[model samples]
Target chain A: MPIGDAPPLVRPIVGRANRPAITSHRGRARWERLAPYLLIAPAVLVIVLFRLWPLLLGVNFSFTGDGDRNGTPVGLDNYTDLWNDPVFRIALRNVGLLVLLLPVAVAIPGLLATFIFLRVPGNRLYRTVYFFPAVLSPVIIGSIFNLLLAYDGPLNELLQTAGLGSVDWLGDPKVAIFTVVGVHIWATFGMALVVFLAGFATLDTTLLDAARSDGASLPQVIWHVIVPGLSRTIQFVFVTTMIGMLTSMFGLLYVMTSGGPGGSTYLPEYYIWIQQGQMNRPALASAASTVLFLVMLVVGLAQIGLLRKAGRED
Target chain B: MRELRVTKWVAAVPMMAIALATIYPLIFTLNVALKTRHEYILDRFSLTESLRWDNLGAAWTSGGISRYFINSLIVVGFAVALLLLFGSMAGFALSHLRFRGSRTLFLACLAALFIPFQVIMVPLARTMADTGLMDTYPGLILAYVAQFLPFTIYLMASYYNGIPAEIVDAARIDGNGPFGVYRRIMVPLGAPALLSVGILDALFCWNDVLIALLMMPSAQHRTLMIGVTSLRGQYSSDIPTFSAGVLIAAVPVLAVYLFFQRQIAEAVTAGSMKG
Candidate 1:
């Protein structure tokens, strides 16, 4: 009967089990009070010490100097250094580029989910193939794309056969960021599509039926029905897809570009890697980490604000 | 819904094309993996004329992916086990057993979710090194648990939220303590979420390149993804062997996806719905 399983609404059983002895009652009281904390203690400790503590430590550590400057305080030196670096500037620029492209990333999945939900021909097969890429490591995706997008690779060979000039997808500074961004989208859009499908599962089919009865076309049905119905899901996808872009592209950049021929592929995450690991500038890396956090927070909060407005209007 | 069928067929055409595009890259890579270097150099797009299985063996051994593969297995295995254990415990407590600072703790966990690993990589690396846990398997495993445990707990808590309270109270009436209820009831009831979250955690730990790279700096400690990254430098001229290495790393994920696609999708959306 699984009688022992219960939900959170159960009133706390206070003194239900009669205990005659004072000491035993006190012990039971103490155990009841501490039980939840005991269960949560390991998780809370790990989160506090590792995740939250590191955030505070990273920000605090950023003000300190690295190497020769060592343990001594050097407030704003790392910040100024980060501000002056050309590669850092390019990293920030690439972040701006990602922000501009967020909608296309969101839309691709949104539209695909619509097709999948509507049960397009071979939809079952389509969903499997589409979602397969999302499961793969970016390292694998990047390697495959590296092969496919290599200068004399298959993509170029196909282009040449079509009488097009061979384009250097990875070697060109201007094109490399877009290429990486494209591959990232290719790999992740399926995840967002699945989320959108889940949202569709909760959708009011009556609304769609009414829209279709009114002779609504496909675009109108999607706009008037699905978008408004799945506002929360849409917003969720927006924030997450953006976050995924900001943080998860390191492997792609590492394998595909390594911050590139002209440093065109330097996202802040990649910048942090190079500074902390390769450049031996942990302090500077901390400063960059703080900046990345601030950037993420701003972008995240701003996205929520915008999405809420858009959601409300819809 | 009946009227939508014709339009679905229309939409299906392009969706199928996109699906082919999605599947083509890996298929393309698999084909490349089977080709000899000369065959690949002759034509990258053409199908291989012969089944050359030796490339996989060569990449497995001399290319050094096997060492990294074993390393990944050990680290991911332990990290995921710890994650599920800790995650489900905290999740049960947080969802069902309200106490002092419970809300605050949950909020703190969610706040940690906002923190990208890159944001903490520098200070974390220092913390790890300071404790002398750096460049080792336990160090890497612990780092992964720290990185992913929040998402795991969040998912499990939400999953546990769906179970009815009567079950727990009933268990209590049967003389079960909190831990007893967790083990006898919550664990069994939460199997679906456990499987879903477990697979997701496995994928995250398996696919991670950044945390592993930062935590384990030495070549011998490299995970499979790192092995793939390193292959580019070593096998630049041997495209087929490099592709073979990539196939070796991808096959496990491919198998997981094939078997548990629905669970993966459910886990992803469980996260979205909560957020």
Candidate 2:
């Protein structure tokens, strides 16, 4: 009986000592399993810290009286002030104008892509050429177009040689926005063309062939078959183009006009940058950013809603 | 036969015009870059009488393009590497692992796809300042990695999903661990996605200006795009030099695009159609 009791006590102590070793083994396995997450944690943390956190802070700052870098908290005055400000109003109008003119820019690439998709001779050449502008930086595109559209630039010179009146492309407020839009279209259409070409390739050739055999004209085939197949691509391009128009248009406005000649070409993005970078109005910039965010969110949601409706109907 | 011929001709006309319009700007820029100041001013649209290699040399040397080129390479290189390593690992985990909160993590990443850079520019800049990361190469790379990782992860994850799972299970049966599976099986199989993502991310980083402008404000670390922008103000009168800088800034990206056009074309088609 004494030996039995001693053996039981010794076994329990030995088991306790070995318990740590077993726990460590489990820990090692767990760590191995979690290593991939650890690898990705840096990326997730960076995005959350830099991108999402800043967005949250920006929203918070927009509401307070934090007009500059150092300030005490105030209430919703920034929003009210923007409502009363004419420059902001003009910026809003400019954005509206951008939306109106965006379709023309968007349509050009789609049509170009469709033509390329037909595999007409020189399709590769067309693709290479069409994609050239996209490879050029926006600043370059802006500068090139600036020289072309300047009062004494080649565009006006060509017009004069052709006996057409030489109009000031960047000077006239009425047409300044149009010139910016035109350049914006030219600068970006390559990426759009590439995307559309991609969309075109996925189109069911069999459906097209069948449609053609049934005596569907080219226009009808495009209208009935190709267009339907490309509906998803159209949605992607539309949303991205809208977002680009809203955000990336700043590069063009910056290099070309600097929102000059009475701020007729002033975009909201340029407006925000000026407030933050130049004027030291961090609060106002925050407010503008918040507004920009809300606008994008609403527009993006509307686009999704429309696409879903269309998807369901089809 | 007659109708088919007419159809072909009709299609060719628009395609040709679109192609010319696109190609003309690039050609015209090149032509302007080669011309003397006198020639540029005399006839802005005309081709140069003589090729000027000196303009390119001047732009490369005196225009501080050498520094800018190196800076761009550092930023783009680091950003692409980080993006690939982190993005592919995350993609593999999300697609392969059956852990809790995996779906939620994936959704969080997907939501990030919609947030534009404009929305976060000010706060992000402020954060960089607060952390003393401003005006550093690492700071710029970190920002770019954060900005681009979402789309990269999404693309990689989708591509990984398309990959057959049997190979992973087979690897597991063959005594390969998860990391081994990822390294030995998934990555090699996912090479196409990795290549396309690498090219696209490189292009994006090379062309980007806003982050470079805000983060690396010094001329010493300025990117080529920023360098070209600065040339405009400095060489306001010398249109040819400015044009030359623009041409120099465009060459690397154009070269890459031309070289990988086939892969890029396929990737873009795949992403757009499937997504």
By TM-score, the best candidate is 1
Q: For candidate 1, give the lDDT.
A: 0.90
Per-candidate TM-score against the hidden true structure: 0.96, 0.92
Tens-place lDDT digits, model 2, residues B27-115: 88889889888988787876799788778788888888888889899899999999998889888877765555667778888878777
Candidate 2 C-alpha lDDT tens digits along A174-287: 889888988888878887888988787778899988987788877787778877898888888888888888988777888899887688888788888888888877788889
Question: What lDDT is reached at residue A42 by model 2?
Answer: 75
- For model 2, chain A alone compared with the true chain A gives a TM-score of 0.89
For every model in order, what is the number of clashing pairs? 9, 1
Measured against the true two-chain complex, the DockQ scores of the candidates, in the order shown, are 0.60, 0.42
User: What DockQ class does candidate 1 belong to?
Assistant: medium
lDDT of 2 at B33: 87
lDDT of 1 by residue, A1-314 (tens): 12232333333345444664566646665666677788888888888888899999999999999999987899899999999999999999999999999999999989988888877878788878889999999999999999999898889989999999999999998888999999999999999989998899999998888888888888999988999899989889888998999999999999899998889899999999998998899999999999998998899899999988887775
Candidate 2's DockQ: 0.42
**How close is chain B to the truth by TM-score, in each candidate?**
0.97, 0.96
